[model samples]
Target chain A: MTSEAPTDLAIEVRGLVKRYRGGRGQDELSAVRGIDLGVRRGEVFGFLGPNGAGKTTTVRMLCTLLPITEGHATVAGVDVGRDPAEVRRRIGVALQEVGLDARQSGRELLELQCGLYRIADPAARSAELLRLVGLEDAADRLIGTYSGGMKRRLDLATALVHEPQVLFLDEPTTGLDPASRLTVWQEVRRINALGTTVFLTTQYLEEADQLCDRLAIIDDGTIVAQGTPDELKSELGSDVLTIGLDPVEHDRARDALLTLAGLDHVTDAAEGLAVYVDDAAGAVADVVRLLGDAGIRPGAIALSRPSLDDVFLASTGRRIEGGVPEMAS
Target chain B: MNETLLLARRAVREVWRIPAATIPALFIPVFFLVVNLGQVNRIFPPSTPFLHGQHYVAFQIPVSLVFAVSSATSGLAMVTDIDVGYLDKLLAAPIRRTAIVWGRLAADLARGIAVSMLVLAVGFAFGARVKSGLVGVLLLIALSAMWGVAYAGIAIAIALKTKNVQTTNASFIIFFPLLFLTPNFVPLDLLAGPLKAIARFNPVTYVITGLRDLVLFPDIHWGSLGACALTIALTGVALTALSLRALTRFSE
Candidate 1:
């Protein structure tokens, strides 16, 4: 897995690791254990994980902001360890924080960023970016005065100044309002359509499902699952029938449904019991009858296709949002 | 080079727009100068031997100039950048890392000049005159500004090393002793034995002495001026190297 060539991939990582040296009285900590990843060119690849799952750490290693303790990684066909400067030239990065100098006006900051990247005609380029981010009218206004959404958009524009081949957005819309998040999604689509590969790290399940062409779900510093949203969801090959019941009765429901036809498994859910079955339509009547024979009354029932949350639950025994594993019986 | 200039220009604009940052620094040094003159003006009359036929304000002008310009402004700004993540943005760029430090120091130079001019004006309004003439006045401003630029690297180094606002701001406190141990109050000979011995070894003494010479003497004191330039150059080299080293190891 560590030997895979990355010539055609936007980003490739093999057995990548990051370790923090401990100070006095503290033990050494490993943030990212060995992990392998391949992000195809011209696609939005989401690195999805919960907080403290090493999402930002991995992104930082790839962006050359943090050094890799071991293993090989490359961005834009350049080895990150061997030629980080070259990798930097070919990649753009917008971290979780907006990273704008609030003292400067939007136009001034963009122009300065353009100059740093050595773009020709900085003013024209700055103007073009301000328009791209829908900040043209506020170009000359200080960044301190811009709304959170405006600042995030301007930050996105700054990353696009050099037209980088690979752009890294770490939680691009993490703290944004719903409308701003949608606008960022549109911008991601627009950039990807223009042939730039995007590597986005997000904890939002909906964001990964909506924007990522493919994604890797990370848990506890390891890659637990990887695939397109549909592929991962379809792998479950079962419909989720959430049976609302008393928490104490979950084990009883699980026991009664174990012998039902088309049944895969049952897990304790937040509200009740989550029953996985090959044929939810066929298994519904059997589930109610079995629980009835056991003298348990079922409440509201919901049947739906497996969602990314379900996929995450299946892979890690936990829902991404809830961050707590449901007990399997 | 171009990247450095671009960043420096942005930093200068920050200095221009945020008058709040600079005004407080200016106020403290100017206030001290006024109060010190009020206390000691009659004692160090124009006819006093070391006064060299000039008012006490002329002798005190160089001290105020040094105090006014030596601030932790750039370091405070650097910590702010780190807090706001702007430094990370620059670090991820393809530009040379040293350019970031150079850019901040360039703004320090600009700030040093402006503050030096204001302090000089206050001295002028208070009856201080530069006997070494126009060239002396220009050199006085230039050298004061250079010292500020040199001293700024300490704060920057601290900011990069600690990456904490309070710790970085505390770097300026280290300058208090350096400023007091110099011949800031009177000529070196008039000081007490042990105090004079300590001031002799202090680098700031030469800087103050050289600047004071311009105000009191009729011509350039090449020997003291050379020592002053040499001190500023050495301090600049050492502190700048410390900051550059801190930046290189920032990720570690």
Candidate 2:
């Protein structure tokens, strides 16, 4: 695994795919279609996808937990299929479920992980990680007694017990409270700052936008878009103006807004209209004037910068769960 | 190696944390030993050549020990680990894969040995004596514990293959019929026909006979004991291979 660090890419995948066969002569289901990606060293990379979008499967393959049906992948310069043991040695993974052994004390669990990795001075390392995760006081307590957030922190600490070159976290804070989520976000930033390349998968767009240095939006097992958060958002345009209209004259309002000179794109939102224009400030008056001329007085109007949801809508044609873009089914 | 021993220590710690895991396995043997002796002694088959008015309790102690050892061989904890994601956690780590199975089997062997000593004490309390002295007692416990580890392969195979707690439990339940159908209640000499025919081939018959020789006989019968050891060794090796294969094919 340490023979040669191949280029600067910490993770490289070409046409990666996974297919699960259905029983009783049913059609096979493709969990992850062919996907090509290269994640560079020392960057927090995010994989954003809805439920069942193959995020976990891709992570599992990279971490050497799942067999790749068709494709080639390398993590930390080691071929995953050729030497999964080496890939496992170079990578750390905290799975989606945070599966801690309940019978073992938190400290005992970390020590066991250190033992598995054959780390030196496991006792000293376990104490250091316990303090790092803010579980020093509760280190001796059985993991079964810990709260959800505590378990997550312990999981994170154990993943770092080996000092892996790359770390993979699948939905690290999916069910945590706001404060707990913020704590996990800090841990991710801290880990990335320490030069450990982090590959994160999160269902929450906000979490991805906040924590990710670069992100890929995965849909239907295929990556729909990939870039930094701002790059992806700016790809859709500068600003979005949401115009609320009566349910009766929605078509007329859309037609009028489409005719505006500065508007780049117009979409039918849930309540009213969403128009993307290059210069929102310069185009607001034109929007009002056009709608007023059409006798479709808007009940409410707003001009704002386009969020990640807008970028998501532009790419996937459907919003991420609980977005500002008209929670339409 | 070290990895296997460490994992085995972890399994032992889990058993320590949950005392209830060993209670049912241990109690079943004690309960059966007492109930079998009380009921069978009253049946009064004085004409029987195998146990004719002798230490019938010693003959029956091994039967109860067999049950204790077999019942103690379950892999429910392993199944629970699979269900709770702990198994996946271990799989993702860098360790020898066989350590996972060895760890569980080792813990069961430890429990089986403990239960054997406890039942041996109970047998003595009920007036059953071992003519082969203290060494015989140790050998009996060691042999029973060995068989316990050997028989555990069934549950371990099911656990690894199915990774379901209920399914592992169901497999253990299905194994009970074989226990009663063998020469458990009566000596093979008194039995005739297909029952005796089947009992001759059953591995349990050898295990019970091995334990019975140690208890009622004056000296060590090397020939009979070797047969018992060979059967256990063969069964243990076969089951270990099956379970190890299941461990290797875990991803499927």
lDDT of each: 0.92, 0.84
Which ten residues in a row are the worst by lDDT in model 1 chain B?
B168-177
Best by lDDT: 1
Evaluated at residue B218, the lDDT of candidate 1 is 90
Clash count for each candidate, listed in order shown:
0, 0
Cα lDDT of model 2 by residue, A1-329, tens digit: 24444578999999999998788989998999999888999999999988988999999988888899999998988898888888888899998989799889999999988999999888999999999889999999999999999999999998999988999999999999999999999999998899999999999988988998899889889999999999998887668888887877877877777677766777767678788888988988898899899987886778888877777787777777754444321
TM for candidate 2 is 0.95
Local accuracy of candidate 1 as per-residue lDDT tens digits, A123-226: 99999988888999999899999999999999999999999999999999989999999999999999999999999999999999999999999988899999
* Cα lDDT tens digits for candidate 2, B1-252: 377888889887886778787888778778887788778876745345676345667778888888888852457887878777788888888887888889888887888788899889888988778878998899999999998889887787889898877788775676576677677777777777888888888887888888888886779999879988998899899988888888788775
**What DockQ does candidate 2 have relative to the true complex?**
0.68
True contacts kept of each: 0.96, 0.70
Question: For candidate 1, what is the DockQ?
Answer: 0.84
DockQ of each model vs. true complex: 0.84, 0.68
